[model samples]
Every structure is written in C-alpha cells, then in structure tokens.
Target: MVFAPGEKPGSESEEAKLQIASKQIVQNAILRAVQQVSRESRQREAGAGDTPRGSFRPGAGELTKKHEKK
Candidate 1:
C-alpha cells in the first residue's frame, strides 16, 4: 500500500491506495499517541525520585569488581 506524492484521497488513481494509506496513517497516529503517554508517565514517576519500573539489577561483572575492591 502506498500513497503517491501530492495525491489526495478520492482521486481516481488513488482510490485503493488511498484507503490503505488512510488506515495506515490512522494506526500510526494511535501508536504514536500511546507511546507519548507512556513516556510521560515514566517521566512523572522519575520526577518524584522513584524508579519507574522498580529496582535495577547490577551486572555480575560490576558487582564482582566492587566486591573484590572491598
């Protein structure tokens, strides 16, 4: 499915392509909106000095190095 440059929906040549392209555009918009909302939620949590998804795990190598230094 493709939309030609400068083509508008309902133009005879763009009929089938237009429908497919329009649907794709709407789906992409919805996905982008969802992503934006999720990012905002994470930021708000971080601004409060809280981990957004809970604890982080240290890599085994880093943990071992720290222990060895001790």
Candidate 2:
C-alpha cells in the first residue's frame, strides 16, 4: 500500500519510523550470524564435534575453558 505525499498510510512520522525499524531488523540478523560463525570456529579450534541437535553443554567446544566442573 503506497501512501501519497503529505498523506501517509498511517502517519508520515510513523512511516519513517517503520523504515528505521526494518533496517535494524536486517542489521541484527547479520550480526547474529557473524557471532555464531565466530563461535563455531573457536569450537573447531578446541576439537569439538559439529553436533547441532545435542544439548548445549557449557564445555561442549570453545566453552570448555569457560565452564569447568564445579
């Protein structure tokens, strides 16, 4: 639904806000993927297996150093 100039579908300011929100959504998704990849790489360096379905343990991979037995 296109809005005519000076007559926004909802409100002019609201349309601008929506545009900013959309941009942030895309940016957040990219950031999350990058972080996940970095984590996976570190896991590989630690000799952890690539198992996606198993329960996430603290020391499953790179997290080994981070989570020691209590």
- Winner by lDDT: 2
What does candidate 1's lDDT look like per residue over 1-70, in tens digits?
A: 5657887655757577799999999999999999999999999878767544455646623646557755
- Root-mean-square deviation per candidate: 9.6, 9.8
TM-score per model over all chains: 0.48, 0.48
Q: Largest TM-score belongs to which candidate? A: 1
lDDT of 2 by residue, 2-30 (tens): 77767756665766879999999999999
Candidate 2 regions with alpha-carbon error over 4 angstroms: 1-12, 48-70
- What lDDT does candidate 2 reach at residue 45? 71
Q: Tell me how far the alpha carbon of residue 19 in candidate 2 is from the true structure, in angstroms, after superposition.
A: 1.0
Instruction: Please list the residue runs of candidate 1 whose C-alpha ends up more than 4 Å from where it truly belongs after superposition.
Output: 1-13, 50-70
Cα-based lDDT at residue 15, candidate 1: 74
